[model samples]
Target: MTADTSVRFREFKMPDVGEGLTEAEILSWYVKPGDTVTDGQVVCEVETAKAAVELPIPYDGVVHELRFGEGTTVDVGTSIITIDVAPGSGPAEEPAAAEPPAASVPTPTAPAEEAEEEKPKGRQPVLVGYGVAESSTKRRPRKQAAPAPEQSAAAAIQAEMNGHGAAPAAPEDRPRPLAKPPVRKLAKDLGIDLATVTPTGPDGIITREDVHAAAAPAPAPAAEAVPAPAPAPEAVPVTAGARETRVPIKGVRKATAAAMVGSAFTAPHVTEFVTVDVTRTMKLVEELKADKDMAGLRVNPLLLIAKALLVAIRRNPEVNAAWDEAAQEIVLKHYVNLGIAAATPRGLIVPNIKDAHDKTLPELASALGDLVATAREGKTTPAAMQGGTVTITNVGVFGVDTGTPILNPGESAILAVGAIKLQPWVHKGKIKPRQVTTLALSFDHRLVDGELGSKVLADIAAVLEQPKRLITWA
Candidate 1:
């Protein structure tokens, strides 16, 4: 086909969706070759280490080619797709044929030559936050060059010594096993070679189950010495069956696992539990639900509990801090980004409410509502999950009594709230039923001593027991 010289092609590269994320896996593509696309229209969805994010095309164009297929893990700054910005431009001249390269170059000089050859013909400024530079590189006419006899001889000798005389295989020409990044990682972790595993997934894709089956130890041969004994039938191979299935951990689950492990190991955690009577807090929750100001807002025990925690933090600002291991110091935060640990279908994600200390009760309720809704939809942004100072995990929602939760990475403490149950207790010197719940506070012992943690926990318990303490303490 003739080249359309007048048509300007734009390449869109994979971007770092989260801060410092180096790579992402393309989950799916919304546009294909020759499809008309508009500026700011979502072209693909990618799953980064943090979350699934939709990428929008920056300029209007017709899709020319998709460089990578879905489920491919592409590094940041790698070209992912090409678009013809001037698709209506008339076709121009036929491109010149590429000439054969000179043979027998020294290994050290090859990289430099490749770099020079790949240099762009022109450069243009990229859109902000896209994370890739625009290059206007045009194909240059190549000139054929013949190798020297001595150089060819040297290359052959070198290749012979390496046990491979054939030219390196092109990536597209080679048979690459079809598997998602997570499955590939699972195979690597299990020490199973993907090439040896039989794929069972759609389109000959290798799955986590296939990797695990490959990694399973083979049955040992029957002993020759037991010839007289009846022959033992071949051992049945264990397969992932109806009773059990293996799910590959990836995206948010993988990140959460790493963060939890790091936090559990790095922080010297000290957990303190207190059983508090939260009758007042429950009553306040009901009152807030009926109040005109809280109409259409999420009004629950968690809301008041969050407010109580903020008030407690205000009273004990020392609790609102993080241990800076790199700096070898305790970093105190002036403002609270209150993280509410949300359990989604993907995994446990903690998307904090920004500047929660500054927000009024109504505003905090609204933010909480939005955060919960976004998290349930699995659309919590990576930015929303960062910079949390303290976190609250309400195991109570699941009918659990209490738990000593591990702290989120870079944060000092996490509070676990248990189910509020009505139990018999002495009220005004008489036996009566009261709303009681257990609260567990886990903190970094390095930054928060027992006295400080106890005070913070006590402040929260006091506010729950006496709802008016929020106004008074504030």
Candidate 2:
């Protein structure tokens, strides 16, 4: 086929993959200029406000160019890839005038009954499906006849209405909301809504003002971030002798402070704790560490527990969903990026293990071990700390029995694994030396409810209580 004279370039900009995520760091590029790509094929990996996301080519065409390299932080709506295509590219050219969206869809064509029959059973509704076949870029290729500006807008509108591209552009392509995922989550944690906050971010994006506006009470005087403890008789030591002293926050502690404040004000958080018998999990960890085949694998109970949580999330995906108000949708993830919260000299940090679901217990053990070591050494890269669906904070490492932990920003839930101890417990209907630990669950109540959270917590406890259950095979 003769190339259409002067083909139009479809510039696909990066969009906010997660709710309220504004910017992402380019992690890796899988395609380069002059390369061909198909729809739904991964072209690049981007670390978003919360997690590292893999972006797929929305259409089948030759990749004209990858605008940014790895490690670049590009804002949402910035065109990251370009595709050359004729206006009439995919499928047979239907008609110039498309039918009104769904509203005027033929009643005869309505197959609510038949379509419902084929819908997957027991599956929760999800947004961000395979994505669209094409996108509506701002640039318009020259044609034989010049169309009026109104007609161009109309045509672009039609593309969105027809689902050939993304939803219509926002009223203005203004600077995106500047709030980070952790900050957005902080607002969520505190039940603070962002829309109302006067955006201090570039352009008109909601700023921290939006959060302060919605909150009934202002925050305590800015002070240094010290160790946060559950309400206890021994009050946390203040920065100085004063009731609350100002201590300049920096590094991980500063980042954590900002995120906590944001999540605390915006999202309504709920926490619950459970004591569990982890004797079997400990035994399994010891066995795996001693296994010849598992040599070099950092086997630990935390790894087994992480795997159990992954399994539980698969069984209850609500724990892995994002609450997106813009689309009035729930984004349920199919993959796992498990985060392990670490307490380092820099303070509490969580660096995740990407694609945790694909890993075996041995792999998870090694990754977790490496993650903790890296975090403790203050050598964790930002990429390692990005894109977590669910997290587990091993608070028990500090000898704490159990406590209600704060929800990590962006993630829907975090499992607080308390200190493991040799305690007396009922075994075989009699008291015995049992390795025990407390499993505390802190979750975003808006995205995850008590029932769903309880179900997941119970599943994790069950697996740990009987580690042999993990390997029950025919």
- TM-score for every candidate vs. truth? 0.69, 0.50
- True lDDT of residue 134, candidate 1: 25
lDDT of each: 0.73, 0.63
- lDDT leader: 1
For model 1, how does the per-residue alpha-carbon lDDT over 119-217 read when each residue is reduced to its tens digit?
231222332223222232333444377545664534643443233423543444343466654466677666677888899864476765687678777
- Model 1 poorest 10 in a row by lDDT: 104-113
Model 2 per-residue lDDT tens digits across residues 1-474: 111211234456677665555676665677776577775577876654334455666566666556666656677757676664432333221221111221111111111111000101111111121233323332243456655566554454444334432233344532223454334555776676565566654334443346656675856222223222212113346765577655444435666888988877777889887899899888888888788978976777777888888878877877897667688787888888898887764467788888888877766776787676665545455556767888888878789887777766777888888899999999999999999999989898999989999999998898899876665510
Alpha-carbon RMSD, candidate 1: 19.9
> Which ten-residue region of model 2 has the weakest summed lDDT?
111-120
Best by TM-score: 1
